[model samples]
Target: MTGWTAEDMPSLTDRTVVVTGANSGLGLEGSEAFARKGATVVMACRSVERGESAAAEIRGAVPDATLDVRECDLGDLANVEAFADGLHEDYDAVDVLCNNAGVMAIPRSETADGFETQFGVNHLGHFALTGHLLDLLRAADGESRIVTQSSGAHEMGEIDFDDLQHERSYGKWDAYGQSKLANLLFAYELQRRLGNHGWDNVISVTCHPGYADTDLQFKGPREMGSTLRTAFMGIANAVFAQSAEQGALPMLYAATADDVIGGEYVGPGGLFDMRGAPEFQQSNEASRDEATAERLWAVSTDLTGVEYDFESA
Candidate 1:
């Protein structure tokens, strides 16, 4: 297809897909689409009530939708580990694992692991979850995928090895950018490692939602107490942001597209990659730095204690 949208998504019969932050926004939209295509979606969210409600709404729309609402708080490593363990006990194999949960720019804070909130939750949390579930992903009957959600903001990011947590100084946007950049780095590095180990069945891909209008935008302004910025965001979202469904197209495409290759980055096709149909896109040079990616991987493994046994695969 020249242009890709949700309508182009292929059938997902008998597929077991896992989506983090699946209660709302891009995650919810993506989960609903997967269910519509016949995949049994596991909705991993922080709140059980919201997750059940989202699952019900999807079931209401698609009567035969197969959905499971599971609790997972990405800000806490313990919770992520427990969630992964539970998935292993219940599911035999996983067809797709979409690391779609994340936090954007907000007041300087830390996760339960004591790392900076954005870096900890956005990058490290997903890293640990993927590592924990690596066996299930590898056990799939056929090709399986790990699609990570990155951002356009990654273009401005720089990873500071000296103070990775931003305890010395913190700029919300900069911290957020670093986390997004880390997402791409992790995706690419994972694909590379998989290739090195001849694990070609598991493809690692990355995507961005562009400027999607969702509750994720409000959190930063709310935490920072920036009334003016909050008002501006409200207006900008109305005027510039794409709907959550539209924003989810890139992720959906990355997760299901037949032509998708490992280490590829997907995003909007329109101007500035803000909004449009899903298409193959480019990430910044910083995101592609091999040395930095290796260093970050080592740090992440140390921080979360979730070692990826690529050699064994």
Candidate 2:
């Protein structure tokens, strides 16, 4: 099916899910749905206060919800490692790992590890987190899924192997785009690696929220927008962008949907794949290029120092 709704998915009861950046926005929406579906949902956030508050809000909505909040800043490599350890300590099994938390356009900032902010938090952090938690995921009783969030902006991105940290010069949008492109590449390569290793049981997918009017843009500087762009975004959000709940549908589908294929890219089925119901969305040429995906995988492996089980494949 091209377009799918969360309601069209099978039961997710007894499943245990971990969602990074679950404090608010799409991550929180996805966590709420999973918790409401009788799954144990962990809100992995950078701020304990925000994470707990989000959990409380979810509990208020679903009084019988099974939800817990944990803190880990993905921008820090050490923190990512600790988060993986924390997940191992907290859960015996993790059925779904939603690498949902991310940053948008912002003034240049370095992660705790001194890498470019966007790449650090969006791609590298998730890379390490996933690598460290492989055992727990493999222990999950049924199909284990990982859904990585990519963006339409990836079409404009090119990975700079020479200067990934932007040591020479950097533009916010270029950095953001590269990180998002890395996301798609990671997901695609992950699926391929898993298949080669015969761990095809673990599904990995990518998706964009399709211009949902979340805090990603609103929380940034005022210069990043103007009266005109603000008004445009407002109208665009209302007309083309989906609600947070709608935006999370693809994630929820990819997480719990039966018969979902590995490496599939899902997003809104309407207009330019920007809004509507969740469906198999298209990736840009840059993201879809097989060679780039492979090279990026090698780069990621080199950077993260963790290799996927793909030798046999």
Candidate 3:
């Protein structure tokens, strides 16, 4: 494909998609793309007012777009569970789940569940949400997919099993890397488990935005009140980053592309995989360790009290 775009997305009529952080940035772009293609989209946000505004903007352009704004803070497991329960109650099945919301290199913090902020919201939050929605995904009439957003920073990540929450020492980038790496590990491990359990219709995949110039890029610096860092990042984003729309192509490809299969990691194909067409890419060796994956799965289940029931797989 010389140029792959959202225009290439297949008709998603009658499908229902849930995109976390759909209130802004790549999530907003992706949600709009899906809605344009005729899918009902659930914009899962941490704030209801912001979510409604985003949905209204989408409706202004696509008047018939089916959009629902739901509040679900990824850093809060209670909110995640409530959001999942409401979704299950309202919809018979979910065709796609895009775990796209995340925080960047912010200062050390903890989620409402007492886990590291980045790890809690980026990895565990989506993990628990997916577990809660497994049945709805399985109920889809045809193929169903889960796309967990990962990142290139994952190359620097090392899951400190002993200090998962960085209890002893904390570096913002270090924590962010670990969470992104965990995203890939979770996605691949979920795929393997699905295959083992013979759940051919349900697939798990992973993707990265590839330096998208979105509001998220500034979250960390803003949160830390670092004007210089924020300004530098803003300039860097202008010079080196792709638009949020372009950055979202990889996830869209992984979500609906006919050639995609379970366990694939899709990202940009341009220089350093930062800004180009979506293509299959390899994650770091650490992210591929089976033992780590297994251990993480067990730890996650215990931490979230939500387990993937592969009994019907």
For every model shown, the clashing-pair count is 0, 0, 1
Q: Return the TM-score for each candidate structure.
A: 0.98, 0.92, 0.99
lDDT of 2 by residue, 168-211 (tens): 98888899999999999888888877777778557788888887
lDDT of 3 by residue, 98-162 (tens): 99999989999999999999999999999999999999999999999999999999999999999
* Candidate 2 residue-wise lDDT at 185: 87
Residue lDDT tens for model 1, 64-102: 999999999999999999999999899999999999999
What is the lDDT of every predicted structure here? 0.94, 0.82, 0.94
Q: After superposition, how far is residue 86 of candidate 1 from its true place, in Å?
A: 0.4
Question: TM-score ranking from best to worst?
Answer: 3, 1, 2
Off by over 4 Å in 2: 1-4, 222-240, 307-313
> For residue 217, what is the lDDT in candidate 2?
68
Better model by lDDT, 1 or 2? 1
* Candidate 2: worst-modelled 10 consecutive residues by lDDT: 304-313
TM-score of 1: 0.98
Tell me which of candidates 2 and 3 scores higher on TM-score. 3
Question: How high a TM-score does candidate 2 get?
Answer: 0.92
RMSD for all candidates, in order, please: 1.0, 2.6, 0.9
